[model samples]
Target: MDKVFLVAVGIGILSRIIMLNTDQRQYPAQPNILLSQLVLAFVASSLGALLVPALRDRAYTSITFLSLAAEQFRQVRENRRDSLQNLEDIQLVKRGEAFIEEIARTYEIRNYMCIITSLSTIGLYYLIIEELKIAKNTSLMISSIIGLALTLILKKLLKRESIGDIADVEIVKISFVDECIMKVGDLKGITNIGLKSDRERYLSRGIGIEIIPKDKDYTNAGILFDSGQRQTIVYNLYSRLGLYREHDEPAFVPLPRRNPKKESLIIAFIPMEKDEQKIIEAVKSCPVLASAKGKNLSLENYKIGKKGSV
Candidate 1:
């Protein structure tokens, strides 16, 4: 599209130059007829240029959709293989799991339209130049070349921008309740966690544990009457805890105040059977889940009614 627009501008400049240099008196006196032909040629060329890009953009979108479909099929095949092999794979699989809504914000569809429109205008300019038979002026040819160059650059830039958007989509955040009870099922991250207003809603509804960083730390301290006593007490507590015992610490701990600001991505799965090892392995394998070095609450912890399932 951009290329077409540039072509139009180039042609327009060349046409203007030709008009300035050539004597209208030397040609047939039907000035109005010649003028109309030039105008029609310019319009048609510009429109054609724009239409090509628009169609191409649509084609790209279609390809993206097909690619997504193919990925889904691959996932289905993997699931079947795991099932027949009695492999411990997670049961639940979420369709379109890789797609994130943020991608739409980064990949501006309007850019495609702009490119198409510009190219169309360029095409019009080219047509006008050819129709006028003003071969002496080189401005039209030069401009057309410039337009083509600009279009190629614009395409590269747009593609780079699109790649960034794809990266953002792959890193979307997901939140979910972390449960202590083990169960076999697919779990996905929540888009939002209403910690203040809906904290109770999450708690009363069922398992309230949310996935959290594995490196999270909490400690209890007691004040002693003397500094020496306090120091001794702290030392004793630290020395008494064994390394193995520390490694076996529970995934969740009580907090003085709820802070739901955690970094994680959403994961969705389909559960086919009840197998704890398989479920845990699946969760661990999920891109969102695997990316975070944290313990997650299983879906079993949430006590939402059957009717409230997402």
Candidate 2:
């Protein structure tokens, strides 16, 4: 039993530790935050690893601590929300409330996934060793592999699509009318208001992109018009290609809007460098928002009457 417990705890700790150092979204979690998450993962895994022993020993009283962990995870979500909201005030591009909410829930759930993966590993080990009478060492090795595989599978299953996955992205030129109106892609023209220096800086080095949804019903699953998606796109671009620093001027910042006339989304921004392809790559790599993911629109979805959708 001691050997088995040690194996379970080891597997659990290693699995959850992955979350402490990695996040694809580039959420900018500080060092302190990363440390906090590492501690959280340890506690979660410890609880999950000890579950079988607690049950076998009739130490049911300790099981109630899982609920306390649940409450703590909930607080983690709230803390993430607060941290993001504070950052929103300072960020040149805001991540919007919806995106912030999505991120908060994600952090909370990831910890839960670590716990689940640990429990699965421990439970499978017992099933092999105790139920099937497998050798302990063999069971330990097989269970460890299966446990890590389960964590990866759960992570992949939980991921949503990227901007490049569902949309056609085109890097285009930022056009201007009378040096003040900005025409980005095929969308409606925007009026740029910047000082002479800022305008010169933006036009000479800026990048533009046109985002077209592949299908008509993409508003729900791949909505980029929301402030969060737009901010993410710009943040990616700025991080990759560098950003033009004219914060006060509207034209200096990346702006995205829905082209009501053509039903497309367009974004225009000034990068510190003038690499169009890099800009395209950055926008394409931006993560799709959970709320934005929607079912594709099709003839079957709407009433195909003599007219159109009713």
Task: Identify the candidate with maximal TM-score.
Answer: 2
Deviation of model 1 at 195, angstroms: 30
- Candidate 2 lDDT over 1-310, as tens digits, reads 6666666666666655655444644465667877787788778877888887788778999779889989999999999999888987677666678768877987888778767877887788888988899998899788888988887787678766777875677887666677677777666466565567665665677667777766544353236666667676666666667666646655566767776654457777776677777766777777787765453445434421224664
Q: Please list the residue runs of candidate 2 whose C-alpha ends up more than 4 Å from where it truly belongs after superposition.
A: 17-25, 215-222, 260-262, 295-310
Question: Per-residue lDDT tens digits of candidate 1, residues 236-287?
Answer: 2222221111222222111111222332112222122323343333322222
Candidate 2 lDDT score relative to the true structure: 0.71
- Local distance difference test, per candidate? 0.31, 0.71
Top lDDT hit: 2
| Residue 22 displacement (Å), model 2 | 5.5
Which residue ranges in model 1 land beyond 4 Å of their true spot? 1-141, 156-261, 268-310
Instruction: Give candidate 2's root-mean-square deviation (CA, Å).
Output: 3.3
lDDT of 1 at 217: 20
Query: For each candidate, how many residue pairs have backbone atoms clashing (under 3 Å)?
Result: 35, 8
